[model samples]
Target: MEEEITFTVPIRPDMELEVTRVASSVAEAMRLGKDKIDEIKLALIEACLNAFEHSKSKEKKVHIKIKMTDDRLEIIVRDYGVGFDPSKVKEPKIEEKLKSPRKRGWGLKIMRSLMDSVVINSHKGGTKIIMTKRR
Candidate 1:
């Protein structure tokens, strides 16, 4: 059977940590390794930070849904805010990033690197990021 947990958090400083704590608990219960758990937490942090910083939602909140099974875990982070075109986001080069003063646009890349799969659906209404990790 699948287990699901859902909650909403206001966009504020350190709110991402609350979400990460829950993720850690669920991942631990799922028997994910320490390294995998750390990766999930980091990916989740990036997702939450992105929503907090960029969503521009009137609600000023982020919604999270976690689905877990014996062999897989899926985390969905959503925000009801103005969305942007993912295609337009430029991929940052490490070399340029090191030289640049502003070094903030790596959330998507980090999430993708840590999770098994990352899917983003964004339109004018909002954005939803579905990240999965397989055991």
Candidate 2:
């Protein structure tokens, strides 16, 4: 059997931990492995952070939807802001980061590295990211 959940919240930095907790609870209810749960938490945080940081709308909000099944978990994070091309985002080189010591970028890379699949849809209106993890 599969279950679905959806919710929306403000795109504030302080809400990041709260969003991670909600994702963790759902993953725990689904009896996901500890490592998998950890991955979900991390990915959710990255996704939420990206939405909060990138969104340009005055409302500053994000919508999150989660679906769970016996062998898979899917999460969607959406932001109603000015969107950009995901392809334009280059993967950060570890050596370059160490040399420049910058604190921007890397969220998409981390989300992709942790999830089984990550699909991004972005345009001038908004951005939506669909990520899935398989057990």
Q: List the residue pairs that clash in candidate 1.
A: none
In order, candidate lDDTs are 0.95, 0.88
Off by over 4 Å in 2: none
What lDDT does model 2 reach?
0.88
Per model, state how many residue pairs clash.
0, 0
Estimate, for each residue in 65-135, the C-alpha lDDT of model 1 and write its tens digit: 99998789999999999987888888989899899998879999999999999999999999999999998
Best model per lDDT: 1
lDDT of 1 at 61: 97
TM values, all candidates: 0.97, 0.94
